[model samples]
Target: MLIIFIICILALNPIAATENSSDWKTQKVENVNFKLAPQYENGELVNSKYYTIKNMFIFSIRYIDSDSFLKSSYGDDASSEDTHYIKNKNIKGHNSSIIYQERNIDGVKYNTTYIYFPIKDEIYCISYNGSNITQDIEEMIKNTPKQTMSEKKFYSKLTHATVSYEYSQREENSYNDYYYRTPYQYNNQNKNQWGKYYLAYSLGRSSRYYY
Candidate 1:
């Protein structure tokens, strides 16, 4: 029953994006096998790689420890508008607050969600980009297997599509669902600059894992 309003994100064209032969590669972290898609460079594992969904959004996922992540992201900065804490009612059995951060990089706005929790004796963090903390995202964190790595992808197919107020009355549920049903691309006529240029490279990629 967790729901949040997800605003329209700027879209991009997907090029040089690779698809996995299978799904995710299995790696054991903290005594749990984690399914991951570590970018392979010349057959060797790389730390991070960019994922581009045609006409949607581009994002990257990396593996790092909780302490390093916190220190690197925020160094001795007090709480403010850019950084805030939110309580999630959907995540059960965990006593941690979800930290939300908003950043503007090169005039492009980015939203990040951070969750810190322990797997057995070791603490770990999972983060991702989205306009808001939707219920689906919280459930993804809540159900991650202890000691095992879990992978999730949210994406879409339409390159020219934009979800706007004019088309908001569609009956489909979930943001992903909305994209799945709405295939008409947005025409910039009479639209504002933001609306005309909105793009999300991470649409229609939900519950998918790759190797």
Candidate 2:
């Protein structure tokens, strides 16, 4: 009887934990509506919303005007060779552009996935940095309600300033020979700088120093 009771408790614990971990809640930014697991850390920056899960995976949504939409709809021009397109197809009734990026940071390989689509005058970019969460992130993008943004423009200089500050800090921490290195070296020097440029260029201003 004791053994049977222990086995029953073990089986029930997993079911309970699974239920709790899968508790997804709906969230809205502007007119777009998407779902996120209850256990998440989220923040906002200018025209962007960022969410972090399990302290490893990061997801973000940025709203940009038509011009920036067209430019980023196909990924960046100065992207590193480590980045490439995965697919461009319809996912859950929405035409989405997806890309895969890999970088070697301090001997550890990091992977990121990005999805972009346009809704009305604004383009929505959904990106995740980490592993084993592609399916969940895609579902979040697919489940998002496609709604038109208002006519009021949503550009922010603060986003550019913040990115610039972050870039400077990254440079300070990078190796001394960073500037003298090859393009690939520079790209690896600051993998996060790519996303910073995304935010900068989205604001219609190009960064003087780019990787």
Candidate 3:
């Protein structure tokens, strides 16, 4: 009976591995390409690539045009007491700007980092929500190559249409839940209320995507 139970567990291990492997697919947004699993928020698919490591941290990547990058706000968070920006930092041969933010949500503190770098006409952003930056995350950043239209155009295809970039805002009275507001919303209503808590909230949430 012991040997039979052990064989049953071994047989099920491959099935679980296959299911997890099938969840990820190659996705390309604008000029950047990467592998991501389909993540949903409120039953809708999001517009970024994300991978969760050990169920503790989430690493996501997104890119937008230079025009959008300049127009959007990065710093200035009213909700978070600690927010810092380090500019012209070198990461894997790319000069990047890093945003380190900390927020207290429902008595829990969350730490998030955003690494921004320009690749040709677009600005690529890699974000991680965790206290410590692990070696695997560093490896992912180091291995992130410059993807262009002229390179491997036949093999890589754009998976989703580019949406106008907008900064995220945390929903009122919610833990780890956030909603994105367009540039027009900010301009017309709360332009001065732009913050990084939304970005932190969106990424810190369980398996949510962001642009």
Candidate 4:
């Protein structure tokens, strides 16, 4: 009986697929191809630059030194904005542009801004694999935002999406967010199919850094 019930659930998994209205989109930033733009690679003060790949502006600036901004991909804790958005709560996650609700920075309330960067007036960030060796990218991963599959879309299976603002702590900043589309499966027999994946994903939080 239990096996039959489980089978029925899996068969109806697609029906229970929780789709976010803002989940995946077919649109994408154009004209720019983000190339890490590592400071160590360029030797400090990477200098902001605009690329035609995504038409977004990108910069690779160094730490303020006096202030503790731009620590690591996720190791930053000095920004008042962080605490302002979360407000006495622990940061659940972060990325190029996937900010949270509220956090405090410098005793002032602020939004926990995501890593998404800014261009001439846009935002950009990069995301790679999510199920390979790990879930989320920490300061240990390539100095880039390693978003889970949930945060990304493939160019093939997307309809439409728009971008807002792009931001970064670097000088040679260029692109920020990418709106692509990927394959999406609907299986009723997999209600909690991705639950484990997501749980592990949420747990694979990014690391924080301080300069």
Candidate 5:
């Protein structure tokens, strides 16, 4: 089964300072048939669950030949036909977003927020997800140091990465359980993620698609 091996980013709050929260702006755009969500603008917590503290941004783009776009924009081979981006049905619903690691592109930097659909060979569809690539960029948005978008560099670094595949093998048992592993390639070098985090891995079969 195709499962989304999500590296749950126990992400930290934005750390930079900004004064751009003049007011909250919420706009929804539909690209082709899918939707586009470009920024994180607000937050509200309900029933012990954070309704929308807006830690993520989302956008969807549909292409007749989705593979072509992924290859050109992200690399030589990409697909999004199988990619799924679930909506809350209601604006207040919570769902998952597919985001790859960040990277630099064409002298500009942006963290990628996209999901891919790799068909027989190339990608079939994709969605522009979110990016919080650097500490400075994150700080600027979260208004960590402060909380606004005014004086900061007006841009965030976005990375479009090659799709990745991961696999695991385990002994089958009557009862199902899970374990944890440290994240790969993330530099929390200067940050202290101490008692604030945990990881879980299932010892049985569980599949999920990220969109």
Candidate 6:
């Protein structure tokens, strides 16, 4: 009788097959909606540029095919990292290794973290970097909901979804043509050297700096 009941339950709640990333289910958690972006190569998802949302945060998710590939991409950082800080955290019920690195870009110092974890047969690389870090961004990892098989489809869609963006605000500073000063720099000298300071702005918690 128990065996029969188990069989009935299995038949009723059949496992959902994995689908491509394009068809993955999207859900909103903590007022943020996460949708999969397709950009993969050789069965691995690799987005050259991050997807920025809300003008303050940026994120990227990549799929690693095998342990061999994971080592190839993260050989030095995973093992012989003598300078940066490395640690582990339980994320989404999985033990994820986190590595911190810092570098100066255009005179601005930016902090970054590389988070690596495995799910089933493949590994995931989730990373974020910015001039400032916040608790909300840190919570993003912990609060991510466990996805179903159908939701996993979004990750697979990245293989064919690597289309380039015509103009993304995230990459606005990269192009040289976008800069034009109004009212002239000479005229603004009398003005505050740091002009247009706002009275109020949101403050985010700072992450650990490399050095």
lDDT of 1 by residue, 105-142 (tens): 68987676655443443444445566465544444344
Clash list (residue pairs), candidate 2: none
TM-score-wise, the better of 1 and 4 is 1
Q: Please provide, for model 6 over 1-211, each residue's C-alpha lDDT reduced to its tens digit, 9 standing for 90 to 100.
A: 9999999988875532212333543433222343433221112222332233311113555555544455444444444333277665656554566767665557866466667554443355565664332343334444454433332442332212222121232355454333554456546653543232311122232222211
lDDT of each: 0.38, 0.54, 0.46, 0.29, 0.28, 0.44
Better of 3 and 4 by lDDT: 3
- Per-residue accuracy of model 2 over 28-101 as CA lDDT, tens digit each: 65566667644333544333243334222255665544453434333341144767545555656555556677
State every prediction's TM-score relative to the real structure.
0.37, 0.46, 0.42, 0.20, 0.22, 0.37
If the candidates were sorted by their lDDT against the true structure, best first, what order would they fall in? 2, 3, 6, 1, 4, 5
Q: Write the per-residue lDDT of candidate 5 for residues 108-194, one digit (tens) a residue.
A: 544445433221222223333353233322222232122122211111101233332111112222123322323431334213332
The CA root-mean-square deviation of candidate 4, after full C-alpha superposition on the true structure, stands at 27.7
Task: Using TM-score, give the best candidate's number.
Answer: 2
lDDT of 1: 0.38
Candidate 1, residue 165: Cα displacement in angstroms equals 42
Better of 5 and 6 by TM-score: 6
The better-scoring model by lDDT among 1 and 5 is 1
Candidate 4 minimal-lDDT segment of 10 residues? 156-165
Write the number of the candidate with greater TM-score, choosing between 3 and 5.
3
Evaluation by TM-score, superior candidate among 1 and 2: 2
lDDT string, candidate 4, 62-176, tens digits: 2121111223332232232432332111112322233232544468543322333332223343222121212222221232233342323311111112111112333224222
